[model samples]
Target: MAVPALDTARAAPHTRPAPAPRPARRPGRAAVALAPAGLALALGLWGIRRENSMWRDESTTYQVAHRGVADIFHLLGEADVAHGLYYLLMHGVFALWDGGLLALRLPSVLAMAAAAAGVALLGHRLAGPRTGLAAGAVFALAPAVQRYAQEGRSYALVCAAVVWSTHLLLSAVANPRGRAWAGYAAVASVTCLLHEFAVLAVLAHGVTLLLARVPAPIRWAWARAASAVALVLAPLVIVSQQQAALVGWIGRPGQTELLGFLALTAVGLGCAVLPLRTSAAISLRTLALPLLILPAATLLAVSFIHPIYVDRYVLYSYAGFALLTGAGLEAALRAAPHPRAGAAALAAVAVAALLPYSIELRTPQSRLDDPMAAARAVRELTRPGDGVLFMPARRREPIMSSPGEFRGLKELALAQHAVPSGTLHGIELSAPRIRARMMTAERIAVVTDPPGRRPDDTPQERTKREVLAQHFRRCAEREVQGMVVLLYARPGAC
Candidate 1:
């Protein structure tokens, strides 16, 4: 006799239940995502100009972006190939508005907003809407995120690409189809092209696939997509290597960086071990833990042999941090006897804690040096026909950024203009030529790094110092936030 049908509907004790269906995209989804994007935009725009200040790096962006497209392409071949795309994008931005610092920085604000939205939607897909909103909010409020959101750099755009690509990766993992994987690969490749360090993020994505415990076929699909991204990035990697000296300044992680990483890792680990289930198919811990840790940890590890660890390089990891933090907050809310009150209290505490940092990030003092402030000082210290020199040629950035401030001051050691030469700073005259140029000036303005910086020992820099010391007397000096402006006159003229 046929055995009575085993209880068809009943679950086996050992086997997992079929995963709950993936949440269908709802009409409210856009609204949910938009909330965080709006918040990030508002925060980014709050002090976008930073008291009419721009720093050395931002000045670089301004000068480069204002160049002709052909010139930008020419410059990319020599240096900063990594930021080629961003420079091109900013070219378009300035072409349209040319609103000075506001135009220079608005793209970053918009890109960061997009990134925040991506984080929210990713969290919603993995956990729930509440978690998504909380995660996005956390990311927006993160001091680092706030800092970079207003920067005129590629980091924010790279962050947007990474986050959205990860969102697509989630979709591909859920569906495991060719089109889905292709979509993921396309965006992932762009992310890498934006900045090759984003390849670290792709590696983090691989760990995420493994943590997801997806089927063999899905694993292969992910691998194929990731490999394709790498293949597309190969040329950039090669070119950037030739320009490695650009980042040669990075050093092994310092104590403060190490401590911060460890503390954040501890918090992430705690969130990962929370007794909460994200979904039947994948856990929030699996999705976010690797995203949060792998990119940073790998960079930190590699820095021992070759120090390339900069916190901004892995800023996308903040999305992961926000994701896990959101879950932890949600878990706390669920476990509390009064969820609404608990959320209110949590919100109040988070705002209070982050408010000071938020305000600090918008000030001119937030950056290493204010180029505008230095330029202003140069303008005030010297008259028309006076010679202006940068102690290290690189310090010319402030003058380059605000050339109007030093309108009639001669750049005594000049050769070619920066844009014409396709270099960050123009090629300086030889040491002998610079010294001879210095000898003729009646009064000179010199911009130096803040006191105690290791003095540039290059021959040209040495010549500048020697000429100034031997021939000129200090007439006046002013120390700005991160720069020193000094006026020198012929010994008798002083």
Candidate 2:
């Protein structure tokens, strides 16, 4: 009565109530957000036990982190300065649970999962929700991502930090605030701290900022954030440079590397040209194209002056590749008559393509050297008190990682044990001392680098070879993956 019998039909037009708030969209949004992390964890945990043995690089991680923290810090100064931060993180991991291989590699698995989530989130911010889901899924399934996800190394962690930092960067650029920029700086600094090469991601960010039509304030904020990150990372960069000899083994980029880069460029370009929806303020092409190409290109260009390019060093670049791949697939599916079916078919093809590589990664052959296999071979062949020799001196590394396999045997050339010496391979005795010890042993076991590697021509190595030749006969020889084991005994005394 007070409302005068209200104009019901007119009110109906005005007060439709926003279409009931669309509860259905909430579930779909949640699924898209969570899918990437779920796929990452499932794939990461699938073959967690397949590669049971630690490879040489992973063995180095285990040995280094297992050392007392002080010893690890001390060793970092002399060698492995590049992995110092990762080792320190692992030191804490081992302290909580020393449950062998699983314990050592679990952190990487978790880190990669977080990285997958971040990749999805970044893709979503750059392109859309569908692209984010696709990108994250692609990242989880990429061969390199799967490889590092299962290995005990810093690359996966670095990739995670880079992806999240990129996400933070997008946020900072859109809403230029002190706190947002500071968050970007902190996350990027951590990424650089994990692996100094990750600082190259900032260059990718710079390219994104330059290409985007952002306001001056946002660009200046990004520049300030990047400068802060560099300042924080400068100390680590200086220390890592002083330890440059650690990477001396990396030769100039070869034909294989060039081919790989070309392939990556082709893929990124293909994605950029696709008719994907992107914001005019900051296009996915602007961000993803540079992120995918520049870091590796910059590293390769610099390699002409100094050979610093290693594929794994720029592993975070793969996240960009993944994002591009995701966007490309989404564009193709959207163009198709049936988008969901197209997406399913595309996913199935991706899984089929990745299956073989995934299987190969689980095998011992995936690694350059299997220290665990070497350790097992040694354990099977040797008896207590058999003298051991590392032919090139560096071959001692595998044994050092599994000292228990060599517990009762005498390390004929070792001047000090790795743990006691705080070194990777323990120091070797002088040439004279090594030769003298060789002559007295009735039986000795030798571990050598794989056959056909250039022989070590150093005096100590020469003396080692000569003494074994003159005083003993090869009683038995067995080859293990990435190594050779020879049993030597006095003439007529097998």
Candidate 3:
């Protein structure tokens, strides 16, 4: 049996029935599909209004965008992000729109919502319409996706491109045609522009198509897609120094924490597929594996050598995995002899699974994400020569480091608002140095979260507040609603 030629397959008769462009479902069917999508998106948008409290990353984003394109290129020419693509795009965004938190972040929110739609379409194409609807609905509700979507970052956009590219990957496998490969190219190109890690996604697709074990042309199509990505990434490779430095901090994500992040990735994926189960079957197997086992295994496996333990690092895997899981569950439901039972099981799993995620949604952690607020509030509070010292300055470093919308301090610096005359730097410093730095300053503030610093940070760093308090006379502490906006003066800075 000679392998079927691409041309012959192209000429082959359409055997799979064309989907009837069915006259619309009853009035609410469309509404129901979109209901969760809308709610998720709306809430996400609302969430970001407060998301920008001048955190280190957000500040950097704002600052980088504030630079001239030439300067940005020069910086990228120096040290860059997951390939300088997001920063380069952000450069244009800051120029056109207000770099305010909400303004800076809208693009990601829209992109995330668009991704939700893609998840639905991908699910629909792989499983069926119901699966598509369920996938879209679940994508909309996802806590992590929503959290990232509302912020000004590369993750949400990457998620959208991943969905689009995954759909094309699916299409190419199902129908190995030139046009399908062409679609793959189109989507893969966007993924390249959005993130370099998306390269992993392209690789995954190659493995998928290879497994489909299609004819030469189909394999060639994947080859073409891979080749395009390589060609596109060639220019970016010039910035390897920048890329390595950014990722240099790959501390071993302890086995438990590493596994936890992987689990979180799964929960997001599983939720996207749960509702699309067949009407008669029952079981959470679909939601259990990719959203659960596979990611856990992937992380555990990856964490050994130098720890590939970052959650956002594997964002591409999370989306595609979820779609496949959704597709599988849908197939199981449709194939189940007891469709009603299958449906009931899926619903039960959804309730049980989501109840925890939902609880997480309602918690304080969800709302405390205001990194850019510090700089914004600082801008409003300061007078000329109002000396600003970020005592236990290490906590403030991430914010000050980037100095932009990523941090909210970029524009402030551009406007020449605060001078970095003195800073405590770290908690390890003797109380005298800390006191000396604090006492000399007219207006001193320490940037710390009351509960604690970032969980991933060192234990020594967590003592920032306690150590600083011993030396500096706590003049006036300002709790800016959610963040620890502590205000201290030198023992006496009149």
Each candidate structure's TM-score, on Cα atoms with residue i matched to residue i, is 0.93, 0.93, 0.67
Tens digits of lDDT, candidate 1, 1-494: 23334543244555767889996554356876999999999999998888898888899999999999999998998899999988998999999899999988888899999999999887787788877888888898888999999999999999999999988888887888899999999999998888888988888888877877888898899889988998999999999899999898898999988897888888878877776547536677887888889888989999999999999999998988988988888787879999879999988998899899888888888889988999999988888999999988888888789989999998988888888898889899999999888888999999999888999889999999988888899999988879999999997876
Q: Which regions of candidate 2 are displaced past 4 Å?
A: 1-29
lDDT of each: 0.88, 0.85, 0.57
Query: What CA root-mean-square deviation does each model show from the true structure?
Result: 8.2, 4.6, 12.0
**lDDT tens readout by residue for model 2, 1-494:** 64644777668878777755543342244666578888888888887865577777888888888989999988877778878889999999999999788888889899999999888877777778888898888888888889999988999999999988888888887778899999999989888989998988988998888888688788888888889988988878788888888788888899999899989889989887889877436788888888889999999999888999988899889888988989998899878999878888887888898899889888888878777777778788889889989888877766867878888998899888777776788788899998898888989998988778998898889998898888899988878778888899999988
List, residue by residue over 381-411, the lDDT tens digit for candidate 3.
5445444444334345434533441322221
Q: Looking at model 2, report the run of 10 residues with the lowest lDDT sum.
A: 20-29
Better of 2 and 3 by lDDT: 2
Model 1 error, position 285 (Å):
1.2
TM-score of 2: 0.93
Query: Any runs in candidate 1 off by more than 4 Å, and if so which?
Result: 1-27
